[model samples]
Target: MATSTPEELPSSAMTDEDYGAYRASAALWAGTSVLITDQQGKVLVQSVDYRDTRLLPGGAIDKGESPAHGAARELLEELGVHTVVDRGLAVDWVSADSSGAPAAMRFPGELIHVFDGGTWNDEQIAAIRLPESEITAVDFVAPARLPDLLSPADARRALAALRARINAAGTVLLENGHPIAPTSLDRAGILRTPRARHHFTFHTAPVPDTLALRQSWGWVFAPDGRILLLLEPDTGAPCLPGGTPEPHDHGDATTTLHREAIEEAAARIARTTYIGYLSDPAASCARARYAAVLTAVGAAPVDAATGRTYIRVLATPEQALQQFDWGPAAADQLAAVHQARHRLGIPRAAQQPVTELASPITW
Candidate 1:
């Protein structure tokens, strides 16, 4: 071909040999980690010798390596076990810190991929053999407690990843240590705040007249089968709507349920069906659990009892149950919601992430 002027050259025909800008991918660093949890839903973190902070069992990805390969390799090298680690739980893009040690250590910004390693039992945990260097110890820490123990970025990423796994829906994109737009689980501050456990003898009937009522709670349901859940800012623990019967309730459990449901969740429940009660004889009180239809859900207002607005959500029964530290009781609690839904002619809710009731949904 005839020699073509720089300006006359076709875009595709222009050669990088003369005027190409240097585009180097090497400027950015790449790291990989795995989200490994025990049966109790605690994340496994490694105590590395290079830093005071703890981190998930993962490290830098090497040249010519895919993130998955790097993660599997790191797991094999660090945990000393051959395992299949796939499924992207989260990918966090950390910006280059100017004054921080990373900049001084000759490090640039990083793109880290976190993959799901799934749940490991006691035997799998026992199988781990740490290397003689880098990692000193490994421990399974609660996701909420990760921030206290692990690095801030790692903590945020871990919590987000755990929530993603619980959501069982998709991957999360993050920057720094927070989600770009927090989901309902993130806004509720769950996985970071501990779940409250209710320990009592669960009954399949209404609170007995003989039992002194301590509080009333319900698995309030929407016509769509979603259950109404309430969260207080103090703990971010999801609880069924309802409370102790006040003098206003006139010693009626149903009355207490109706009033408290509106006050706590801004929800109006109709066609209530008593499912069961949680009898705590040691505390000399019983907490009644009922299943009711959500007739109307309004705006969440400041709860007079706590003086703080509660975070109201419409969650599947399973989502609500999994949030508690109930373990086996989670199954039974789910059963209670089922019994309520069944008797009330509401179908089981399709599995989904817990979502806030930002706007009113009236049936």
Candidate 2:
């Protein structure tokens, strides 16, 4: 057998122009079916053989077929999972190429239509026959853990959307049909309202002070895409490094967050990019919350108050979720942290599993 030298190889091997042109002529489309259980909120996923990566049950949409129809068909054919097609979840245009850029010789783009479908129980799911050529295994995954099972980008986008739905579903009513405002709640039947003619008279009397409550403040951020949380010494659960804002504090929430970072974690934050807020108003307290991206510049302090020496490093979101010690926050707090990270443009691969903070009664 004769081995060809680099210089002796045919020039045809050096160029992909022909292949590129052929790809350009092909019209490409894709679809993904998201099987969700109303009872458990778990999605059915399949593990692909190539990378042992998990993916939603789906495949390329055939010619002359709608994406939704394609998704339904693919689910039944690939996994033998029958579902009632409800509506489209997300319609994203992605590249068929790994670079996620437009193909040089193929169609301008590939459309990924995600359709939401009703879910199945463990027994029901166990009965399905998955296409062995593409799917290696199938399992039901909680919405919160979906990020760990799928590609970073796909997981982040999906999780963000799932959370938005959950938050919307958790809306509460206060009086008649009106929703309760974060800072105020009605005290008609449950608690008595205070009444006094003069301010001095009110001060003089031993008036019931059941209405007053303190608010919690904090800045939530993703450090280099990973969540930077502190283990509260008291609760031993993970929490964003923040505290109640003082009366004299200046600037916006971002500034307060910077101060909190220094105080709680002994880390210096160079800048903060705002994401959104969560309302935590209840019998115990009321808070106007804020979240952001916390960028670090240099060394971290050993101690916040003492200003002792400390080691500083950057970690991906996954690392933070696995390593950080959590404290008293609800299990849903982890999901909240992840939602904030998704909004900050952190890729899914960098995100860590947050301990989910429990939903408070106040909403």
Q: What is residue 69's positional error in candidate 2, in angstroms?
A: 1.5
Measured with C-alpha atoms, the lDDT of residue 168 in candidate 2 is 27
> Residue by residue across 254-316, what tens digits does model 2's lDDT show?
556667666656555543443323322333323333445554433444455534332222334
Q: What TM-score does prediction 1 earn?
A: 0.86
TM-score of each: 0.86, 0.38
lDDT for model 1, please.
0.80
- What's the distance in Å from true for residue 145, model 2? 3.2
The alpha-carbon lDDT assigned to residue 4 of candidate 1 equals 41
Lowest summed lDDT over 10 consecutive residues: which window, candidate 1? 17-26
True-structure Cα RMSD, model 1: 4.6
Per-model tally of clashing residue pairs:
0, 26
